[model samples]
Target: MRYVKYAAIRKPTEECIFCKARDEVGKERENLVLFRAKYCLVMLNLFPYNTGHLMIAPYRHVPSLEQLSDEELTELMVLTKRCLKMLREVYRPDGFNIGINIGRVAGAGFEGHVHIHIVPRWNGDTNFMPVIAGTKVIPESVLDTYDTLIKYTHLLRE
Candidate 1:
């Protein structure tokens, strides 16, 4: 039998997690952050829909993408594409769901901080688990996914 472990903790802070991650260094593994570019950074989603679910956010804590500078916008796309490549090489997903949820009304969990989601998709990925229990069954742990993806992040710089 296989079991999935879920770690749910509440962090009481006014600071955004992405902002905290930017300030903290040498803690990528802990943060589930795979790569850091000049303007944007990639991190594994704490609450993921699939195994390779990633989020690319900029250093600035802006509520909307429109607030981002031209450089931030450009680097955000580049890093997001790199993340997709890494996901393809590691998970070999059949397809992907990539987009940004603008506001709380649009299902943005972090409506205060804009980030793009890159969720890996495969054939027949949807199951009745979520429909019945409202819980997503991710096959792998966030740390394991981070470990796998981090190895390929170096290739992005090459």
Candidate 2:
């Protein structure tokens, strides 16, 4: 809920990524976005630490968690749970790293809107490449991951 100054500067753009995805429902597949709903959308992280690094972001174009209504907060949390379910079914990951980066200094990529991250993890998933080359290995391509997740979104709301 900490208001960051930089978010104010980036709020002018009409075609914000979250807004655009909200308008285009199933087209998330084209954008590597795994799923989209009324209050939030799930999109793959272009630069991820693991294979299925996805973000659940609110549809409203606002910065900081404090800006969200109680209903919006409820929907966002629901979408977060759905994301975890989809990832569990598709990736079968042993664990997950889930959180939010609130401000620019706190590593919020899109500081204009608060989002939750759900990153799937597995045993021995990290290797020498990440340690030595500063590159994390992803077993599947973003598109493939998108396809895998999109297939499971149908059962998510249940």
Q: Estimate each model's TM-score.
A: 0.89, 0.84
Question: Model 1 segments beyond 4 Å from truth?
Answer: 1-13
In lDDT terms, how accurate is model 1? 0.83
lDDT of 2 by residue, 1-158 (tens): 11233344455554566667777766767667766666777788665667788877888878888898898888888888877887888889999999888876887767687888888999988879866965666788777777777778785576
Model 2 segments more than 4 A misplaced: 1-15
**Residue 88 lDDT (model 2):** 86
Colliding residue pairs in candidate 1: none
Determine the backbone clash count of candidate 2.
0
Residue 8, candidate 1: alpha-carbon lDDT: 22
Tens digit of per-residue lDDT, candidate 1, span 61-126:
898988999999988988877778788888999999998988867876667789999999999998
Worst 10 residues of 1 by lDDT: 1-10
